[model samples]
Target: MAARRPARAAAANGEVRTGGSGRSDRRAELLRIAAGLFATRGYKQTTVRDIADEAGILSGSLYHHFSSKEEMLDEILRDFLGRLLERFTAIEEQGRDPKQVLDQLIEHSFATIHETPEAVALYQNESGALSGQPGFAYVDQLGRKIEEIWIRALTAGQKSGVFRDDVDAGMTYRFIRDTVWCAVRWYRPRGRFRHEAVAEQYLRVLYGGLVTE
Candidate 1:
């Protein structure tokens, strides 16, 4: 997933809402702050008060926006995964070829990391612990859907000879998935290489052999 872009200005009322109207802008800000905290501090270690303090609001004020820290987590993950799956599905449906689809997928994955590093990191850190937890089933369900899209691209490429046939598509997809998403740990918005440059260089190595021809 990508890092979230910067939050916009909040409403004058100083309240954030998770399920209501008129405060979406402030609500997004609170989610951003909470995602940062959850990514840096373990979810188990983070408190609603911590999120409230970061937002410069009282804990009670935070509750007006979210019923609990868990709700915030759920909302963040659902939004992140939902957007990602929607984009990936569209890429697969509309791409000209398997190679094009795969390239867009890789590029988009990097872009996601750049845009929503906090959410990406939060998912990476907490997904395992969240497995089978009540009210978190969608975490794994959406993950499988996302995985299927990648694997389908890989399979299509191999069948069309755009990718090597000897390699297992499942294994190749796993390698690519891990290599791309794990970049969240070191990728910086102001780093030496921007996400586009990183994706370009990765695609170069991925499609071309490391050895001189």
Candidate 2:
């Protein structure tokens, strides 16, 4: 599934939205350029000048949209994680059986990896160090909330006999979480297997043991 882009042009709290079409498009384009650079180059290594150079704009023009490179990073991560958390929370709230919920969650994750590999990679790369940094504590808090949803589903499945009771829920959750998210390392968006195919095969292996009866 293609990742949805947030509308960065809108204003809340009675703040007026002002920008011509050209400026808005350029702003979005600059963000795209920045995200790509941040994902490919480490965020700290990527300077505002780098972003401006990639966008073919001067640093002054780049600053007109974002106060600093940190602002750009914050906007990218915030939007990426915010959208991800919202989707996962919605899946949890649908009240499906644990197995179904887990299936959807796993599938959605693969799709996310396919659609927003850059964002996924960025989070994986920067989140640990950012945890101790001020103003970025929400990174860890949001991560914990996401972890809880997955663990809850796993526990529910175990209790309902749909999953094994032998494994600890927390450990199992960590294993599954790492396995799914780490695919961003090698997963190519245009690879031979599409995200849906990858998800289906993974689910097959997950639900059925490797040993054939």
lDDT of 2 by residue, 70-152 (tens): 76777667777778788888898895799988999999999999988888988888898798796676677778888888899
lDDT of 1: 0.87
Candidate 1 structure, TM-score to reference: 0.89
Question: Which candidate gets the maximum lDDT versus the true structure?
Answer: 1
> Which portions of model 2 miss their true places by more than 4 Å?
1-16, 20-22
RMSD in angstroms between candidate 2 and the native structure over all alpha carbons:
4.0
Best TM-score among the predictions, by candidate number = 1
lDDT of candidate 1 over 17-104, digit per residue (tens): 2444657777789999999999999898999989999999999998766667887888789789889988999999999999999999
lDDT of 2: 0.80
Can you give the lDDT of residue 28 in candidate 2? 65
Model 1 segments beyond 4 Å from truth? 1-22
Model 1, residue 170: distance off in Å is 0.8
Query: Candidate 2 — which pairs collide?
Result: none
